[model samples]
Target: MGSATAQALVASSSALNAAQGITLDVAGELFSVGRLIGESTALSGALADPAAPAEARTSLVSRVFAGASAPVQDVLRAAVAERWSSAADLVDGVEELAVRATAIAAPDADIEGELFSVSRLVAGNADLELALGSRLGDGEGKAALVQRLVGASLNPATTLIVTSLVRQPRERRVRRLLNRAMRIVSAQRDRIVATVHTAAPLSAEQRSRLGAVLTGRYGRQIALNEVIDASVVGGLRVQVADDVIDGSIAARLADLRQKLAG
Candidate 1:
């Protein structure tokens, strides 16, 4: 949620626009870097520090990503050099560039990962989600937080995906932004984003059955994202895009108890 994060993502998008013929693996690696930077306050703070020697920060980036592609390295250096409003802003610029490159690198794989990550962001926290998705905060603030989150992950594709989100209208909430993003990604690649939350991971058989049920009901092919949520207790919560099918035992018991009390 720092300003540098936003600038990083925006810078990332610009980098991706300049990138050509990047590979899927490269895109994934870049996204990982962006996410790492975004999520870790220490790392972002170090990089965003004006007093910190540019050489030192750049050197750190190089050492960390020595084995990465030349393009990715360039993107990282460029992002750090850019004068982001805050550490969070740094993340935004870098991530934007990364995702665009990833979309070009591996359309199918990148779209899935982007949707999954964005949705996960929505599911992560309430205050952050609201702040990023609210009109009360300016684009600069939103961009910063998004950048940090995506920057740590460092996928060119992830960056590109996040950049688009950062550019949307201010009225959208984080969850809505994620949903809209999932739809765009799905449409681009002819896939569906089905977010499934459960007490534990679904078995292969369960996934298959659930996939079939969702596909039949929605009339679209889906890529299932299984999110393990221990708080759900004994039941499963299946979210096929916007539609939530929660059949958790805890919910049922609570419902029954409430009715009895009533």
Candidate 2:
């Protein structure tokens, strides 16, 4: 997943940095590039496009995000500039790097969350999400659409992230990478997340009750991500690793049917 990839990059960079004594503050620029890539399918496709030469692609990224931190540009060149082969792969690489850098820049903060969340606000809508993340359009169209929607004067860090991903693609889903990064970071500090699915949106009180129940049952603090799935039919399904607590009406129906058949 994206988080694992980001962590791998982080590990690689950590070793590389330690060996070469190259330290960087890449958060601002990394964010810039990550944002740009997320906003532009064309940019993502272009970066990963095999037709373009690596040097040319790297130069394009640098030119587009000229205002980003110099260190970030260096990191881009080192991590993805020459290694990317497809659009998806490049996006993944750039995104992973940005996620990692963002985490390091604000170790105890929610910078990555803020970045991804706000982006979801803009690109989260179904139409835009499909346009940006889908395979319906070619690379150029994706870039143009992104620029049209985001405008040219975005923050440098955001721009860098977006543009780099546009040019260099990743193989994994962007959200997955980000989530994994957040999870790994949180786990290191003893924070774990559990996703809760419901037949419909849960009330605040319900979420609170679920959280308390899950905490008591699991014996560990948990963060709940609520999702609505009408098919679940009036019950909850808490999924944490191999565990599943199905309180769904659907399950009850199946049980009843089985009993009748017996």
Candidate 3:
């Protein structure tokens, strides 16, 4: 992220935080605005143009998002009023705000965990991933497919988030979109996500201890997204962002085999 975009994100996030009585409706409106802006290069450029007056950008937001609720409009105005490094960054900024809004509205739901699960599902199913992420498919079809597949099991907030993203992926792969949403949701809660792969699910106490250890080391709250992979054989493989801690028996055997062969 560029310096300007980072500053703009903080500003927009603050504006979202200040809004009272945030609801799923607010998140829907923000997503609608983000999608419209992302689809129009001209609009995004005009809004994010550094030379343009901030007043002009905010006025454009009012004209374009007139149908949005007051809170949504307020957040958009705040976003356009700041300087972004690029037009695409402006669109991403709005999308982040929308994701954060969804996280806020669903305070009781495990947004990161649910999104991670969706990502795993997509990663494991090639046909399903192609169907959802293919550019040739109509947005409505993708949205309906998403609803039919996971809507029943997901929280209302999660269903709304998944449906909205599948409808307008904007060239992101399904896994990429899901992971990005999970990252934003984790950041919104002031936590980081650690994906743990093990032969079996971790016990609640094990999970707590792992989270505490990671939090102490990283100096931030840690949210674990556990995956049960039988191929792990034993032990755990944990990843946070780019860093990996691989202790799985499969990895150890592979290392030992490579050493003996050399």
Candidate 4:
């Protein structure tokens, strides 16, 4: 994220955090507003234009989202009031706020885990990914497919986020969108997600020990998203942001091959 966008997101996040009575319904409404803005370059541009008067920009938000709840309107105003790096960044800022709001509303739900599962599901199915990620796909149809696929298996908050994202991907691939949502949810809880790949599932005790070690190293809670990958051969490959801990046998074998070649 650019500095301007980062600052804008921080401001918008504060607005969301301070708002009272935030609910899943409010989160849905925020996503609706984001979808509308994402679909219109002109609208997003007008809102993000640095030359435009702040009052005018926020007034547009009020006029357009008059039906939104007070908190939604407040967040919208706060978003447009900032100087975004780009129109797209403004749209992203709003989406992040909506995700944060969902995380806030569903305090007890395992939203991060649900989003990771959905990410894996999309990554594993080319047709499903294409259906949801392709620009040519019908937005309504994509949303319906999401509802049918997830049904009641996921938390209501997760369902809302997935359906909203597929309805208006705004050129983001499905996996990217899902990953971003997971990251936002993790951030909401002051934690970071560690994507761990292993030859087999980690036992509960193993997972607990790994999580504790990572938490201590990072000085923050660590949420693990475990992936069972046969290619890993043995051991674990863990990624937290840009840092990768590659102790997997596959990586070791590759290193050995490189050394032999040298």
> Quick one: best lDDT, which candidate?
4
Quote the lDDT for 102 in model 2.
45
Clashing pairs in 4: none
List runs of model 2 lying over 4 Å from the truth: 1-25, 31-97, 103-129, 134-168, 171-189, 216-220
Residue-level lDDT of model 4, residues 79-104, one tens digit each, is 89998999999998898999999999
Across residues 152-261, which tens digit of lDDT does each residue of candidate 1 receive?
67455555556546544435555665555555556544567787778887899988998898889888888788787887898788776568888998788888999999
Error of 2 at 159 (Å): 11
Steric clashes per prediction: 82, 38, 0, 0
Q: With candidate 2 superimposed using the best TM-score fit, by how many Å does residue 213's alpha carbon deviate from the native?
A: 3.3
lDDT per residue as tens, model 3, 1-262: 9999999999999999999868999999888888889999999999999999999999999998888899999999999999999999999899889999999999989888888888889999999999998999798899899889998989988888888898888888989999999999999999999999999989999999999999998899998999999999999999999999999999999999999999
lDDT comparing candidate 1 with the true structure: 0.68
- After superposing candidate 1 on the true structure, give the runs of residues whose Cα lies further than 4 Å from its correct spot: 1-105, 110-113, 122-145, 152-154, 258-262
Candidate 3 lDDT score at position 157: 88
lDDT, candidate 2, equals 0.58
TM-score of each: 0.48, 0.50, 0.94, 0.95
Q: How does each model score on lDDT?
A: 0.68, 0.58, 0.92, 0.93
Alpha carbon lDDT at 165, candidate 3 = 90
